[model samples]
Target: MKIACVLLLLLNLQQVRTDLQYDSCGYWTYSKGFGLPEFTERIVLNDVTVYYHDSSLRSKMPCPDWINTTAGKEEWSSIHAWSVHSRYVSALGFQSATKQFNLTGSLSDQNIYQASGCCSLYPDGTYRAFVTHAFNGKDFLSLDFKRKTFVAAVPQAVLYKTLRERDSATIEEIVAYYRTRCLDRLNILKQAPGVLIRKVPEVRIIEQQKVGSITVTCHVTGFYPPVVQMVWLGPDLQPVDEGVTDVLPNEDGTYQTRKSVIVPEEDVGEHTYSCVVLHSSVPDNITRVWGGGKAGGMAVWISLVCIWLLAAGIGLVVWWYRTRDAVI
Candidate 1:
């Protein structure tokens, strides 16, 4: 049972998604297996990384791009010292955790542990800080400053949280760092001039012909800040049930997402089906329609699903920003 718990921990260990409102946040993640622990850190201002450091580098500070560096030399020196101490603390905690659970599995078991923290400053002059832990690859516990307590994400965390809450002094120290020290760090990092860039998404409607019904997918791509909403609306703009895909990051720092819905083939021309997208980068809502309207006609790149439909002997039609291809 102990072995299975740690194995599950490793399997679930990945970065937790951030739900912060603003982008003045500093993210820290420390992970270790059985070697010299690896420390990775990045500080972002307006979604731009102003500072980055990792254990792989011998130097403490990130190299300046021959321009004004993020922070002063003295600051980097201080950060380096702090990060070094932090790495050991995290590693030691890993040791203590294993002992607490009586995990005496073979060293070949290959274990992993991660501790992450985020401190963000909202535009309304409000700020929030949170720290979470994961073993193997699953969330273990979280700190709730409002309740002044630890919130266990999983049942395995209940014992850990109960034990941790007994130490109020350490809890207070954690709160102070997030509320005061962390926010002050963010203020200094945001002083530099920033470029707030935006990119509007290119929306496409991809249709797949099935035996009795057609699967239509709305693909929204090339958007920034990873914020957008897509919905399939039927006639009269009534919301239609749809299956949504995960929002994935692109290599260019933009984002792509998809929402798909299946409709009867006979109903194609009987009712209007449109995909509506709302995003910050877009001034007005962008709508792409199919059936009972002019299908958007443009020389856009064909989607893979359309290609698959063509090869499968079924028919396909693609619509764009204004224009249509008819189902065969």
Candidate 2:
């Protein structure tokens, strides 16, 4: 007899477990009614077996065969109904329930009668149940599932208060959750009202003329708010201690700047000079060139001109002497 009782108890537990087999895959779709995008649900069965819902389907209903027994079927039905109710409550801010009855017996007018209620079960194990009247009106009942008791209506004020409190607690948690998800997106928008920093400037060496000493003048333009420093870059691409001028802003909200560097006569003959513009925001240097100045082309041109004039004068004198001799 003792062995038989133990066997029966084991069978009962197994039956209960079979009845509670639920595919949370079906419950995942309830979020659509709540205005949330579809997502997969992680479901654990018998406190050990686990499965996940496929995210493709919009509306999914748990199959009756998925539950192992009639009790499991009943439990799943109740759970699904509760889930739908919770979704409605969360989305619409309210929910309603009604008792359904069906007549089957010949002697009795109402043979099948079932009490139905919709409720949201919180993560804390508390629940808010909405029970309806025979006419299916706005009657409700709130229950704490943890304590297994009932309460009055869940007023809008109370619901909003609970939502605010829960949202505050969840805000940081949600941010942390998204931080781990590489699939999520971060939107960086430029929303500054007025212009902070504008166009980048251009630098150019306009002229390099020899006036006793080589004077290199560089022209810079095309920057809003102007640049701070414009200097001469040496052949080695380093800043020289040449004199630089302050940037002057133009009338059209741009800038025009000039700087002159005095070059040594020896280094002046044939060397490349760069005008480098420095700005606060940009890292790399902006530069422009003076002349391709090499081998003193200007001095060479002056010497060639003087030689040509002297040769022409000598040729003329030689022609005059030859003609006079011929006449004599």
Candidate 3:
């Protein structure tokens, strides 16, 4: 459960930089009807989580020596206290916001609030960053660096923008954090005693013979960074039409996904079909070909596989947990 909280936190991070080092942090709270809200705080460096605190656990999640996180008790306590205060304030905010929008929902409907910030640093020593917030899974407000002010993502958020914009000091503080603290953390992570480990994607292919066609499935797993590209290649080495599944998170924070295509029975021996994967972890694209000698030698069965980065709504993560349909 503790580990799940960390993985679920990944849902808050909408997009990840494939070739940049980043320091991103977010505090998320989930509530439903009258139940006490559950809160989680997370710090991610280069898309890998280094620090995590779950309100239910009441402690920072543990990490191995390779992922060294040196946060102290004072930091955890302060974040926890802040989360508690946030839960209270967010509850009131949600009520008023819902009323203002004339939105109606069932009592069982869930509510979520999150404040997330991220800074991405390039090799050339330049950085881009922002601090943003969402309420009930909609973008409420975001920091505009150029104007040094808050902007509303929707009409419903104009009230928040007006309120925060009036507080120039708060805006300055957010910009300072983005420019200094966030980027500093990225630098520290880049120079940490233990460098970020890159786990290459393990690729394999399985074929299932049906009545008039054969289905070839390329299973890629055990990869880090959670960003991967997989495509089906025809015998001519051209991209082929295929069905790809969502990237699923492994317990160890790695990811797995599959791309499958069907081969006509008559064209089975024509040539070969391949699954080519591109990811940051690998120096070159990994290709797994199906057909030829392997076609003759058969395997009876093949075993299977973050489901996040869900922009627009982080509430999907809350729903997955609220109902145990699927739990990583």
Candidate 4:
């Protein structure tokens, strides 16, 4: 009887261990063999969802006052550095999010980069997002976790309500509005077959420093089939004579273009500069400017020349008045 009791106790203990193991391993079983980290943060905005994965799970928590916290600062700094060092991550995230959310009306090879964290307000009070991972190259589909459901925040819920509305406008309507309001009317004249304006080009100012003169270098990309004319524009809407160069083609067939602008010491603070591309598509002209700065060199020079001409004219007027009095 003592031996039988001992056997029964051992059997019960083994069953408890098996149950615990099954519970813990349940989450891992659905992972599909992908090696994603244990900690994950999923953010859903409107019809779009973004998942951020971190091996340390630091990014999984709510970032209340994230801008003021050390982790926030570190993330910000790392993003800035990443923007310079490995911008491919940024590019991939943007492309993936837009496609995943079905934001673009037509399925084309163009990649759209949402600088505002994958969330943007639509005309019909709806919000759209392009979700991505916070880590260097992580993405939503790349997640190896088995959990199918995630918690939704208040803002995310609001976005969901907006997207779920049936009366919301379609992407075609939005594109039509954009075409009429933003694009140049003259572009209609240039439209033809095989002259597609694939994707709108984007310009990102990577580095700006004043080594005697203000030297500005920018990263430009996101156009398909390339453009015949890509130039830098000044604040006055005139082209600058900056040397433009094209970077090597990425494996995905998208090209990275760049242009450098050198401003004289005196005119560095005078005008703003922008990267402009002229494509053969619907929006024939696309421009992207840096966050803040005065107009470019062309604008400054033209303004200065106009001022000098005005001053000379004023001097001539005074001389004419004095000469008239002498003749009298």
Candidate 5:
């Protein structure tokens, strides 16, 4: 019997763990360049596109000093142009932004080359960098800069196979090279002048009267970098298994999320519930409580007393009017 009870308890704990939802987000960084008549440069973090520059828009707006120089223009016009054409032919249909270059210039050659790189910072304090070079829209080569190995995105063409066999020594030397060349550049571009830090989320709790019970909702809003966790806690400070809504993006680049629980009618006034929020910007978890806590209970009682006093005064006035009419 004791063993059965222990197994049952463990099963219950596992269920509880599965019932409460959790969130884990990481940092993503990518650098892309487009070429020719429509030169473009961009950097993205997570899924949000942060920095973008279009050669088309350069004439209308002042160009940033870093990529606006004569040598910069030439490099973008030639090399980045080759990258965009490679993407156009490879046609991988990546969800990331696509660039189309005018076919007028030196791009008449069927051969094209591209170089794109991405770095990711995981929550566990580890980082990884990946780089890919494509030929005429087909993957030609890829490297896991951190692992110092070549990844087969697609089968190596005869030329690549022959070159790899001959230059294996050189490839080995530069396998770890992108740590500075690409990863550091990605970080530097993210911190360029106009980057905005994600704001701390604001949390509030409100009670709603349902048919036979009360539903308490914790509303969180006005935060950037859009990942957050909010949970409703019962009297024991354990998370309640009630439903939580998905985080919705607001118009102003902030995000809003809500989680709710239906409290028993009897627990409304007797027990206090709490909403705990976890976000990256906040060092400590934020807690908001309802049901007769210091702040919430005081306000509720004051409002109730004011309503009672108003009702009593109205009743007294009505009584006085009736008595005056009887005397007349």
Candidate 6:
């Protein structure tokens, strides 16, 4: 089983998708694997990538109480050292996760890293620093700072242990490797896809009736970069805030999404509703209109079906009359 796992890991290493994301919060680094040939069966994109943010500084932005004093400003300037140490805290939390790791069969696994931290100057000219790794995303391991421990995962602990035993690694050494080597590599890997790939989405407005309730849905599909927005507009041109689904992955690596609003039965009228989709690639918002006596209402479908039946009936009547006359 162990040999098989190693082989699979090596096989998956042919392509890498290293995500180096840095927002207003802080910097993060992680590596992921995408298998070759059948690129659809990606591993790293599916795995949980770990990132830690120094919310301590962000929480006190635009001159917090800590920065009021010169001493506090000095501590803040040296935050890089603090940030590196915080990463170790986050890794410790990764090692402490309790989730079971599958060894033999399918390699789909979930990994969590805790990411939160704090550094403050004490009254005796001493610094009391503690880093906690926790985030708001689902399955992110949380650290109880007061207790100074993390909830460990079995797979994470095993990996950490193996690395530690291999090199007699200390916390400081491991943290340095992550900051200097891992993150730098990630920065390079992130730049591999130089040009931003953008695809304008195909948007359409549709109406669905179920249990007497009509849902006006805007179906948006076949887009790249996945960043998109859909908004429903009333006939008055005001924006209607409806729920939109997250951009989901398509087989071709494009994205698809949907947004919907429930229209009151009485309010259904010709040209009463429209959906507008916005994406970076689109020069203008794609507008799809429904209702207001348009082609996408339940009434319109019923009318079309009736019209087809009426035409069929007329043709049958004409044929029968001709045949009867000939027989007489």
Alpha-carbon shift of residue 41 in model 4 (angstroms): 52
**Ranking of all candidate structures by their lDDT, best first:** 1, 3, 5, 6, 2, 4
User: Which is better, 1 or 4, measured by TM-score?
Assistant: 1
Give each model's whole-structure lDDT. 0.59, 0.39, 0.59, 0.38, 0.50, 0.44
lDDT of 6: 0.44
Q: What is the RMSD of candidate 5?
A: 19.9
Per candidate, the number of residue pairs that clash is 10, 1, 1, 4, 2, 19
Query: What are the RMSDs of all candidates, in order?
Result: 14.0, 36.7, 12.9, 29.9, 19.9, 23.9
Write candidate 5's Cα lDDT for 91-174 as tens digits.
432211122223334543233444465664432234455556554576755665445555655543433434443556655544
TM-score of each: 0.63, 0.29, 0.65, 0.28, 0.51, 0.37
lDDT of 4 at 257: 77
The TM-score between candidate 2 and the true structure equals 0.29
Candidate 5 stretches with Cα past 4 Å from truth are 1-42, 46-117, 120-147, 150-178, 191-194, 292-328
- Candidate 6 — number of clashing residue pairs? 19
Whole-model lDDT, model 2? 0.39
Query: Which is the leading candidate under TM-score?
Result: 3
Give the residue spans of candidate 1 off by over 4 A.
1-57, 62-78, 121-126, 147-174, 180-198, 206-215, 236-238, 280-285, 294-328
User: Where is model 3 more than 4 Å wrong at Cα?
Assistant: 1-23, 30-34, 38-96, 103-110, 121-126, 187-196, 294-328
Q: What value does the lDDT take at residue 283 in candidate 6?
A: 41
TM-score of 1: 0.63
Q: Show model 6 residue runs off by greater than 4 Å.
A: 1-112, 115-196, 209-213, 292-328
Ranking by TM-score: 3, 1, 5, 6, 2, 4
